[model samples]
Target: MATFAPANVLDFGGAQLIYELASAIFPAVKKMKGDYSLGQVAKLYYSFIWITSPLMFWGAYLEIRRQSDSILTKCKEKKIFFVLFFLIFSPLCTFILLNFSFESKNVDDIRVYLSFHSRLGMPVWGGIVPTSASVMAAMTAFGIRYFCCVFD
Candidate 1:
């Protein structure tokens, strides 16, 4: 009988750290209220979330399907999909975030808004970087596994 081991320590640790970071950052943003333009930008953010939700769900579906296969096969397939998906989707996400606008009464406030937009831009790159890294890592691991299987 084949037995599947549970996820390792690093995965749980990474998930915990990500959760904490997101939780801490979300409240700071939610507390902020700039102007009517900020509200508009928020609306745009919601729209992006709405549009991306389906893609994320589809990705999750692919992940589940891949997981049901042999580990080496699953890793190879997921790595390819992850790399391709992020390469295509990350720029689209950045574009949406980049074009978001907010109405402001003060020029300084507008500057702040733009600065905030620029800061928010980090998340787009951040998301892509980790995803790409993980994909490459998976590919490496799977390729090694497949090579070993060839010997066996």
Candidate 2:
């Protein structure tokens, strides 16, 4: 609802309804499993989301900017920020994920292992970054954009 919603407006009752639903539904969800603790869980979700969302967002974001660029050339502010964001933020976010990682205490919580399905299954430090769909999407989104940046 937050990302691609047609409009941002939400009535008080509707917002309250969503809040009520989320509050009720969240507590019923399981907290942690296996040797996986909250730290591990945090890493798992954080790793994928952190490493991936910006890249995916960039694809859409850049595409919009590029098309707009060709048609009108004056408002270059969004592109400047977009380029700066990709160049500066991606690596920074990548490093920040380390803070949330597990240190590999045992077989169940390898800090760097292959994540198959659930983040809890392989977890945050899971060696799934290269394999993640988000990573691929980012790579595809930023395709040639990186190299082009170097020349520019």
Mark the regions of model 1 whose C-alpha exceeds 4 Å error after superposition. 1-117
TM per candidate: 0.26, 0.27
Model 2, global lDDT: 0.39
Score candidate 1 by lDDT: 0.39
lDDT of 2 by residue, 1-152 (tens): 22222222222455434434433443211222324333333333433344444555566556644664342342243455444444455545544433333334454543433332244444333444322434444433453354354334
Residue-wise lDDT of candidate 1 within 1-152, one digit each (tens)? 00121223114554345434433543323333434333323323333333343355456445644663565464455665534433345444434333342223354664444433433542343234223433433443334435443333
- Model 1 worst lDDT window (10 residues): 1-10
**Ten contiguous residues minimizing lDDT sum, candidate 2:** 1-10
Count of backbone collisions in candidate 2: 2
TM-score, model 2 to reference? 0.27
